[model samples]
Target: MYFILFLVCAALTIIGSLFRLNNLKEIKQPQGNFIGQISLDFEEIIVRTSVKEQIKIRDIKNIDINIRSIKGQYDGYSTSKFYYENGLSNGTENFIIMVLNNGIIKKYQFEYIPEISFLLNQKLIEHYYKIGIMDYLNCVDILGLDKREDWEKFKKLRT
Candidate 1:
């Protein structure tokens, strides 16, 4: 029947069109921003203005920013700040300052803000940064720090 033949042709045409569109989409590559200073890559953030009903969802409402600068050995402090978003998450902003040292990261303060009010555990930060090194290491443990890497055979990067 001519009608059956036409229907078959129509179905095949629709399927072929969808297949072509999908193939084109697959060929497209995703894009993202590269943080040159640090080894971080993130996708471009876009805002969609949708006036939908507000639901009680728990999520990170603040953004934490930290900066550290050191001049010499055994010196330097870190400053941090917290900021809030007024509108939908959109666009990207970044600021960077020189960090002299990042010896130990004990507690990553979520929504951290640099201020007199910003509270941090001084003792915990100090211990996490240095105490672990001495507490659990012998001469064999620090061999990798050696310039010659005397234990190259012993420690093969674990990777």
Candidate 2:
């Protein structure tokens, strides 16, 4: 029965090693440059990229923000030519960005890079929201641009 005992120990060791490796994958180090910035004023949300690509979403009442997690070689690349020139390594780094006017009803996608994945997660957790759910609410919380009551009314609309 020594062979059976050895097999059980071997299987456990292999499973433990895999669990450790999975944890390592989740451990992210912010590599490359801080290539993006997001700001909010009373009137609008401003997103600025390291390459000088800027987008301003006007009329806070109508705008919505969405966050997406991008990972792997098969995932798409940034449409902006600036990202290519800046030498952003693809697939190695996985992170989320805020997409203004995201989804089918909206024709255009304006994704804002947050420089680090943790920053985006921290912002969402701090605001008590999840991805794909009331993105505008998260935006409102992160930016601190509007009153809680105003956002609450919007949140209740179920649009």
Candidate 3:
């Protein structure tokens, strides 16, 4: 009897928690113009990425309004992210905040760029070195095990 009671209580508790978490936005809604429109209460804060339909929230806060900008995307991987935590209020004038891709946020300074370029040159250098070694073994004074050596070296370098 005790086990059955405990199981019921646990199930109720889990359901209650899920309900509260899933309804966080619903719980916080402004009255007046927002009446009957619970879904639109949460405004989308979007950051533009070159890849269409992919966006990171960057940060979220409960406020009277959300001011969003369409900063167009950049090249490379869009990494280095941070959030401006709980800093905006609709009634207040300090809603502006800056976002830097290096995980830094400046107050009200906003800009967007494609993801930064990686060290492609370094990768190309490594590739050239491997090709040079393979060519040397293939065309120059070849060693008895040059082919095997080249294969092993190239495979290891790939990793």
Candidate 4:
């Protein structure tokens, strides 16, 4: 009975590892406003939207991940405005990617998937180093506390 249980556990471990390895290759969102997929392979990163787009790994200038929150309130009238803030709140988490392509900056927004984001970021950083691009990865927090005093207060509160 002990030997049989050990065999079962070993098989489960192999299956779990295989699943994780396959998941690292591609991430897909089949239904949403951004109904597409992002895949990483040897040569390039492919983004499939209504139209398919391919970006060669070597041509990539920089990959930036932006995290921000936007809150909207109605003034008891016909006007509703979204206020962008610098820190996380009870609102939804937004993930924004700013990519520089052919001298133009293109922005893409998607719902945050923490695991997929972290994996993709790690893969990109690895590839960037292989291709001799050192400073290509960046993370930006878009909550608008640009003032030095405000940033200091925010840091203190967080600690």
- The TM-score values for the models, in the order shown, are 0.18, 0.31, 0.20, 0.40
Q: Model 2, range 53-75, lDDT digits (tens) per residue?
A: 34433322233444342332122
lDDT per residue (tens digit) for residues 1-159 in model 4: 999999998998787666544543333322445577666555676778899988776666655545543323211211212221221222234543534546655456555444444334544444544454323223113333467775555444323
Q: The CA-based lDDT of model 2 is what?
A: 0.42
Q: Which residue pairs in candidate 2 have backbone atoms (N, alpha carbon, C) closer than 3 angstroms, thus clashing?
A: none
Cα lDDT for residue 117, candidate 4: 49
> Model 3 segments beyond 4 Å from truth?
30-159
Counted clashes in each candidate structure: 4, 0, 6, 3
Give the C-alpha lDDT of model 3.
Answer: 0.31
Show the lowest summed lDDT stretch of 10 residues, model 4.
74-83
* Location of the lowest summed lDDT over 10 successive residues in candidate 3: 34-43
Instruction: For model 1, name the residue pairs that clash.
Output: 80-114, 81-113, 81-114, 82-113
Ranking by lDDT: 4, 2, 3, 1
Error of 2 at 48 (Å): 2.5
lDDT of 1 by residue, 1-159 (tens): 999999998998787655544443221221353322221112111222242222111221222223231111121111111111121111122222211124222222121122321123333222322322211123222222354454453233322
Local accuracy of candidate 3 as per-residue lDDT tens digits, 43-132 = 233333342321133332211212232223221112212221122121212123424345555242222111321112234324433433
